[model samples]
Target: MAKLDFHIVNRIRAQVARLGDRAALRHQAAGQWLDISWREFGAQIHQLALALAGQGLKVQDKVAIFSNNMPRWTIADFATLYNRCVTVPIYPTNTPQQAAYILNDADVRVLFVGEQAQHDAALALADDCPQLERIVVMDESVVLADHPLVCHYRDFIDTYAPQADVAVLARRLDEIRMDDLLTLIYTSGTTGTPKGVMLDYANVASQIESHDQKLALDEGDTSLCFLPLSHVFERAWTFYVLHRGGINCYLSDTNQLKTALPAVKPNVMAAVPRVYEKIYSAVHDKVSRAPLHRKVMFTWAVNMGARMALARQECRPPSWLLQKSYNLADKLVLSKLRDLLGGNIKFMPCGGAKLDESIGRFFHAIGINVKLGYGMTETTATVSCWDDQCFNPDSIGMPMPGAEVKIGENNEILVRGPMVMRGYYNMPEETAKNFTADGFLKTGDAGHFDEHGNLFITDRIKELMKTSGGKYIAPQVIEGAIGKDHFIEQIAVIADTRKFVSALIVPCFETLEAHARELNIKYQDRLELIKHTQIIELIEKRVVELQKDLARFEQVKKFTLLPKAFSMDQGELTPTQKLRRKVIQDRYHQQIEEMYEESHKRSPRPH
Candidate 1:
């Protein structure tokens, strides 16, 4: 039996009692920072829960939140839990059809909407979903006139406050068992419909406990959260941050990161690999445009800093000359780079996708500790995370405390822990298929334990590509190897049924255009620029250099330059910003076919 104290609602109540007037959350409203104290946070949750109870939300009733990353999103999440109702979070960027499917599948009766877009999306979905009975708008400015089921957030919460039955809600909250369903997180499937992953209170509690054993946060620390709360990684991380009594600063708009980093200067934050990739590109772009002498000096300083960083990571003392060189490097070049992320950063935990090793090393070279971890929504967001004393660019660190990991048949990473989710919601067949007879969850990721007991993810089992020559190619490895080029923003390797590997490359227009200017290359737009002879030569040179580490068969033989980068809007990227390989290949079938046409003509032994 799980203790009631380990439950999330109880943990929030404990924090309210301990912290009192201490600021718990910070968010922007009308362009001004507003702080919600621990007591006030509790009060809001209590009132919101009372209102939910007024709406006849019984225990285990499904409620949904369709919102961006905001203070209200966090508050509403707890409010739903306080009423003992399961919360379903739909990503803010999810299409109306996606949101509707989740609502219908989860049987969500009451939905808390965020901004105008989310409100409109919900309204559009309400007619299709018979189970959806009411819509509560989080933004006060939303204008929904004479909608029978529509209610302002304030009106809804305040309506039942006067007639609230606190005792009943309290009893329900107390009756919440650890095995009770906490959330229904729908993971987008590779094929067919998305399935809802049912995570119980015990699963979440175990995640918190396991992560806490690996790392502890300071009470005074502040964390900036920009990732969507609908994603398990950010949601679990936020819960952990709150448990530690740290202040959470929510970024409603991801585009505000550049300005918010300086203003908030958060001590810790977690982000996906794309964030680091963009920063790396920007840094290199500026260096490329610098004077020859400055460029040479910067390169020397960075090399010296990387040497020192490598030495420190290995627990070896740097040579006296290297130490002096690093001191000068840190003073002259690295310090300014650190300032870009608001030098107060203690560490930034990066995951949700494979982070390029070069980018990780670059940040570490300049004093930013990017803790790369590996996990999924099923594992409650973190299985293993790199620590202070141990950092490896290749490994995702040892198994986190309380979590058991083993490489099973076909090198599949098998995880068995309290942190693992119970099963897919309402899909017992899928639930049975995903888990082994003995209960270990098949991660679908092919990886192995290194000599030092660190875990190295080789490739995704389902995503591996097999060519006609009977060679298996890991496209992610190929993509990661070449995607770090300053001019290449994104790359997707395509070779599944083909004779040789090729790629669909999206250039980093910012760097490429700057180089074009230096070379006096003329172009009307990106399409024209990519077609230029010099531009093609430049990309070819970069691709050749980047693929030097790859095997002859694994190397990209030919690639077509894409005029535009892959984006979520086009269904080329997932909500978490990972590339949808199949989608990209389908969308650009012509270009991919063109690359293979030449190969078909050259393969003499083939039909």
Candidate 2:
């Protein structure tokens, strides 16, 4: 049976239809209010979908969408899926070249862009990409000029669009089969060119079911989205919000999340570790500058949080003494933290990157539910997610229903389920290689399942390095360890055919600033600040602290902290913020060599 589900969207239409003036979408445009209803939303999507079809767009064709999260973005995406065409999403921050590659790889037939920068990128490739026949500008207010390839989104909809007739559209929807390929997302491969991971409609449908079962979704649930909808993790969550009948209030941008959160007043969120890290930093910064009484109280509460986090990480119940201390602290101290989150926040599901275990536990201690999850694009973005009822701070929790997770011979996590991707698109050999003959998707991550079937990700296979001296080490291990230091914001370890281990770091600028203030030192920029003898010594001391538990050969011999932070736009980081070690090494080969040479010079001579 080919069953089509209205899922979350259908329920919203039924309830809100009774209220004649209720708004389904609220937009603040140029400081003016814009309200849309279920009727208008449906009409807009139906018109857009029909327009696309009228323009010779066929089922299974790739339609490229490049934009930030917006109301139109979701409407356009759902319409594309409804028409049985695939949607390839490009991140807003992607450079022209990166955008071109994804467009070309997918053989995109029509492009819908949100801004001028994205339009310029698409225009740059118009001559080269034969498959790209049309360009629809989402921000139609921009002048299209005389570009033959460009088309205004609203104009196209009105001109050639068929009048939306819902009954007719439902029949067209029947053409979409469950197993048909629906989308292709590129995994930001660390070593080589990023590969496109193909996912089918069934994969998405099953994932929706899994989330609906696991998450405590209620009729009142809503999401304030800031994470790039282009990402598999975020996109999947967005779809689930629609499926669960939850309202999605798209944030303008990640930078504006703090201001936007209060306005949207979301009940639930799924975000990456960096988002939580920023929140933690913001709180810590405030505490550092608070009045004496408030500072003392904040510090005391934070101490209790730290201890509670440690207990959760170690899977130990808090001692009665500690529980009493934390409970009393929460009422007077931690309650204020909730107020900052608009006092309505419920679940903040963290994924995309491994969160520092302590960070997750700290949030839990403060009565904030920050559950963690584990997945790669290969696993359709979620293998396991923390179950609140049976929460374990150290584990990624049990696999979602119908998803099979097993440890392979090499201790690599193997997954098999409807959520597993069809394989890398147009790369048969590569696809064949990624799976075992028995057909499990071999995730290139190193990890194991616990006795209770909770999953843990230990390291990445590709991140494991072998030195020229024949010593092997997991760079992820060293990087993860270094990242735990309060002074380091980001860390990337290097040991690929090199004599020993080294690291590239981006320091905590706020911490550095405070340290400089205490020492009566002044620096104009991060570059100058990093070169200070005091700062270098502090970081070196931290490296030594992390090395205490590591094998001598795996220890960091020397390090360098960059002036600026790593960024996706700069090509230093993937969309997911994973360090591109090869790119970093090549960009600073001489600096790394100098650090290593300086390391030996600083060592005492052997008698």
Candidate 3:
């Protein structure tokens, strides 16, 4: 294959000339949607590049973006790239200490923050991180502190951009190399301190080529940038969208995704499995309460849709009778479901966690293509994704065109590709340990390929639990099954070296409260509500039903319900919403112990 142009700055320049006045980015503010044209986007990147250069930021200097999803995030990202500087992103939900660790570790000279919260966090870190020289606030309405380092974004650009030499910035862009560090994305640190994954322009460039070959994105397509740009999944997709000349509508507040979906009417987007799972649960919960006739109609429509979807997966045409049924089904029920997701979805890429197979199949059955893929920050987002013709809900789809994947010792998924990261920044020993003697990156995930070449992930090798009876269990598989219940919000399985499996569960309070009301159960607060025998019984019944397919030894024998959800702020969840198993086990140690003690008292040698 021929070498691809990996220079991002040149791509933006070419896009500016080609797209001219077309909308390149969009954002919602003050109850209205706003558009930033390609020309405007290019100009902003140029100005910010010049401003950073004027601030004495030299080549390869690290810059940090501590913001939620917004158009300016991408502007700052490209600006840093144009100046040949490495960009480091900090999750907006990260606490002050977490954000400070990234800043100090990356030696970030300039920090771009989103709102007052991030601004305040950065202000608090001023005394701790001495290398942080400048703070540029993205939201103009945020009140600044009296510190000399802080400046509003408008003034920052207006003051420095004009004085800086544009020719010098352009010269640096022209000198771009494939090995230039594109970004340093710190891991969520589920187990320990976050490590900076070093990704370069070559990694990103290969992703662009692979996605272009697999996905059906077009120049006129629009994408909803729903996931945080701090995550590699969204960041890579955003770059690809720009490369394809697609419009990227940024949603700063993720809580507004339900409202924004219809408002934006995006053609393509990328999101984690949690988003799809919630939507799937909500739709089903609503349908379960509908009138009998409506319920019958929904069931029939879904069955018909499923038949059509299966036919397509087999690369066969549906029969005339089935086609007619599906058309009517689409009009009556499926289309309404699709409308909730903007109704114009060409495809929505899902990753970051394993999507429940039922939820994956349901979305595809309703004509909303949810392409389940797999990857990590180290792989620059996508190792494999479902193409148009590949539609197996049980698999993570085929490997990328230029990537090599195989099962190594212990069934670990090993990968060697141009898209793989350089290594962990400043962690030479850790990097050396991750790669094998011949250079395949040990992914730590256990999976296997089917006869058709589809990859099916089994479990995380490090997370597998071994019972005292010598039974090995995959926690994610059990968690994925039980977590699909509408009454459950989050779960963490605890069974490593134990005689039986147990879990810490957080209920979907909204659904639980509604059920409580129906049952005439009274409670003063969430804590009281969870302790009610009727509430516990309700959850226990659901758990038993959901885990019926699992082996007797692998089922969750006991569970404790918490009033609150696992959260990033609490260190119980990663920024991507993955449970930090160790943190949860440590925090709920007593509750877990009590469950096992009670089980032992009931049956001394249980299981």
532 in model 1: Cα distance from truth in Å? Answer: 0.9
Point out where model 2 deviates above 4 Å.
1-3, 6-28, 31-35, 163-170, 285-296, 302-327, 546-551, 598-607
Q: Candidates 1 and 3: which is better by TM-score?
A: 3
Query: What lDDT does each candidate get?
Result: 0.87, 0.76, 0.89
What does candidate 1's lDDT look like per residue over 288-370, in tens digits? 78899989988998899789888877888899999989999889998899889977888898989888788888988888888
Best by TM-score: 3
Residue 265, model 1: lDDT of 84
Estimated TM-score for each candidate: 0.96, 0.90, 0.97
Could you give candidate 3's per-residue lDDT for residues 1-607 as a string of tens digits? 3443545666778899999999999999888989999999998888899999888889999999999988889999999999999999999999899999999999999999999999999998878889999999999899999999999999999888887877888789878888889899999977888999999989998998888788888996999998999999999989999999999999988899999999999999898988988898888888877899999999999999889988988899899999999999999999999999989999999999899898888988999888888999999989987767645778999998888999999999999999999999999999999999989999999999999999989999988889888899999999999998888899898888888998888999988888889889999999999989888877888898899888899899888889888888888888899888888888999988888795454311212
**Which regions of candidate 1 are displaced past 4 Å?**
1-3, 319-322, 599-607
Q: Candidate 3, clashing residue pairs?
A: none
- Winning model by lDDT: 3
Error of 3 at 40 (Å): 0.5
| Steric clashes per prediction | 0, 2, 0
